[model samples]
Target: MTSGIPDSIMALVVKQDGYNPNPEGGIHFETMEPYLEFKEIAVPDLAAGQVLVGMAMAPINPSDLHFLKGEYGQPRRAGKPAGFEGVGTVIAAGEDPYAQSLIGTRVSFAATPDGTGTWATHAVAEAMLCIPQPDSVGDHDAAGFIVNPLTAAAMFEEAKAAGSPGIVLTAGASQVSKFIVALARDSGLDSICIVRRDVHNQVLTDLGATVILNQTEDDFAAELTSTMKERKPRFFIDAVADATSTQVFNAMGKDSTWMIYGSLSPETPPLPNTGELIFRNKVIKGFWLSPWLSGAALDEKLAVFAEVQARFSDGRWSTEVGATVKLDSAVETLVEALADPRGKVFIQP
Candidate 1:
């Protein structure tokens, strides 16, 4: 037990009513404020093999907003705090040696399914789930450590396993997609990147992307078809699920798989063309990080963590934080963060 740690601390609580039935077409300041509240709460008791983390920083990810809207894969209860991953200092721990050893060290942690989340000043997490951060990794980078990097690595690994000559990725300008581009370059695999604007082309090309197509261009379909002919990409990673998803799916090679990981668009993607599916042997699937990480072997999980940490240490993989907000100003800051498309936003609790 840590004698100096406070018994009570401030936290951002998400009530059941937090889900906005209509998010004004999408999540905005007005829609999100009614759902999130800041209040003082009792620190959670540490269970065996658990540690109490004094949260330093947490990012406002797209999934966090989806979770607030109650659209996530797992169910979130009322009166629970909101946040998926963050970096913090372990001030207290339970009886386990591994848990106790984490005390005084800063680590990155993902929120427990049924417990307090990282949006609070204090959060309790399983010691094994808390990966100790090296001195070289900053709080901002560490806060985003678990989600994007690991998912990118896993996606690339899966593509490699399929023995595909190259992979097609939508939302090429997103942070995870950027990581995928870098990972593919390092692995000597080609990546066909699809973005919504022409401005994103040079940046993605600089990131080692093999081909960059602007989805907004008048000749987008033509460019995509020609690129498909040259690349013959066997795997398509879809994040923006809309009409573009159907177009990309139809363009993929025969027997190719389209993995849908995120839905940035408000409208659901139209059904795949039956002719293509029946004759081309195309498949559509979903990929969620939780199950993918949970099903991974312990050694494999540790290896991924080690790889991510090393990448952060060497500046190979990183996240750009646009702004940081205190717990009290989260609502307004989140709106501002959402408006900015360039970088992520962090919460310093």
Candidate 2:
């Protein structure tokens, strides 16, 4: 797979003829007919500033599922590759200066052009678009680290700036939540993690989270309220949004900054109380990775990446990827796990 596809290579392609953004069913609907096909096709030649990459590994992120179902973000054209994040090695480089610098290097890239993505074993990308993998990070960890770590890092800064006493993180057992909790601990702040099950408590508690509240437990709000009374966490990062969450958060003290990043809830996000804002100054906002990271320079982005990597190297930060799979199983693995309520799946492409 390191070598270029001489005649043909397999890829996941859109199967439908016409693109449909708002299909009858929502993004999670699995049509009996795959709009995309997994088949072998001839690989294209590299252009200037482009490099042929042998994809090493990629993670099955929530965004990947959304892209596949046509429910996340703006609707992309059908037949386009679905994955946006991955780590790959430069197998061939074009003549551009940046491309020349990337020869033989492995990197993690941002949004690649349509039809060129990490779902396949190979991709051709602009050399500058890739973030070189530091020598310290292994390929598996590096693959899962970039997108989630960066997002968590950004949210940490946001929470700090908002002047919250501590941060409340929902879906605290997920990979991204691990980074958020680790970052909060490093910053000398406490994190209150909200879990769906009691079993998830040990994971966050071992990671230094002070409070772990299982949403399924009875009178969870009373427990949360009691904890809030001790040391109020004015900042909340909800990777899971639902009506119950809205009610629980509404019960928080005023002047809190709540940022909703993911919608694990089947229902629409619950509306925030205007009274909290009108009288107490509570703020609720939404966050999407593409929009947030879109305009950042590679160097600037790498700085944050470097910091997070150092934390990992020092054994201060770590993510629990519950499962690992080979690159060939990318689609099937993702379809199953994205539907599951727990665990981070890593694809070693």
For lDDT, the strongest prediction is 1
Best by TM-score: 1
- Give a tens-digit lDDT track for model 1, residues 1-349: 5454677978788876434455422233445666678878877777878888889999888788778776777665666788899999999888899988989999998987645788889888889889999889988889999988888888888888988888889988888898899888888889998888766677778889999988889999999999998889989887778899799888888888898888777776688888878999988888889997889999998998898899889988778767778888776566776777667888887
lDDT of 2 by residue, 1-349 (tens): 2243346556665554433545432336444136455667568776777777788877767666556656566665555555677787887776777787787888877546632767667776777667787767776566766678888888888898887878888887877787888788878888988887777777777788878888788888789889888878888898777776686678778888879887766577557777888898888888877766767677767788778778766667765555666555545554565456556666664
In candidate 1 the C-alpha lDDT for residue 343 amounts to 79
Output the TM-score of candidate 1.
0.95
lDDT of 2 at 244: 65
Evaluate residue 229 in candidate 1 and report its C-alpha lDDT on the 0 to 100 scale.
88
lDDT of 1: 0.83
Clashes of each: 0, 4
> Candidate 2 — which residues are off by over 4 angstroms?
1-6, 16-36, 297-299, 326-334, 337-342
Q: How many angstroms is residue 281 displaced in model 1 relative to the true structure, after the best TM-score fit?
A: 1.3
List pairs with backbone clashes in candidate 2: 14-36, 14-79, 15-35, 15-36
